[model samples]
Target: MRFVRLAADYPVTVFGLTFEKLLIIGVIAVFLLGPERLPHYAAMLGKFVRSVRDFANGAKDRMREEMGPEFDDVDWQKLDPRQYDPRRIIRDALSDADPFAEPATPVVARAAVNENSAYLQRKRKREALGAGDAAPFDSEAT
Candidate 1:
């Protein structure tokens, strides 16, 4: 008899491991590990698996404690690699370029002339000793 478990990311499967695949892996392991040493190695493997599960659970609990219920509400599927289809991306990108929309370069072009603009004349004179373009980003200002 085979037992099936529902996975949050993969439905109708248990971490993508099936009974037949596990059986084949077990057979190969028995051959490689040998019957005499199989039990000892299996015990160690079990311990490692338990530790890994415990660590993952502990991390998840800690994250939940810090992030609150919103942590679980995060859309995990959006981060999946399968969601990024290049063909779909290119199509969307092509469609997103509105034919009637103004060009994006105007802001950058305006910024280029801003150094000599009336409002910045005083600052420009002061900074004339060492004029350099400073790109400032404020994370907290957001």
Candidate 2:
């Protein structure tokens, strides 16, 4: 994954494509389409992407309607594609609120610290084994 700064404010992580991968794609496009046809191909690709985006927005709107008044105030446009999952959102919203909400005790805080330390140790071991190096594999690869 690669991080890109949007509007110099928000950092978005993109899952695919590297500089080398982009260079290879450009080279292949040049070879296959030639200079004269490249612009037309690019325009077509842009249009296709726009159409898909429109279709997706339309589908989401329909889903929002089907979901009803509980989600009436939710703004789909503000949703982050990376962090948003509709089912999870709905599940969380529908879950029962704490009837007896109380301040955390010292024991609870100690237990949380112990759990976090154990998690950090496991994460360090995984990193040492190079298990975190796996990149997302494209299913379209031949």
Model 1 TM-score is 0.46
lDDT over C-alpha atoms for residue 7 of model 1: 40
CA lDDT scores, all candidates in order: 0.73, 0.69
Candidate 2: segments with Cα more than 4 A from true spot: 1-15, 18-20, 72-142
Cα lDDT tens digits for candidate 1, 49-79: 9999999999999999999989989998677
Best by lDDT: 1
Global Cα lDDT for candidate 1: 0.73
CA-only RMSD, every prediction: 18.8, 18.6
lDDT of 2 by residue, 1-142 (tens): 2233344454433357666777788799889999899999989989999999999999978987898876777776567475555665675577675534542333533333564588788777676776557744678994
| TM-score to native of every candidate shown | 0.46, 0.37
The TM-score leader among the candidates is: 1
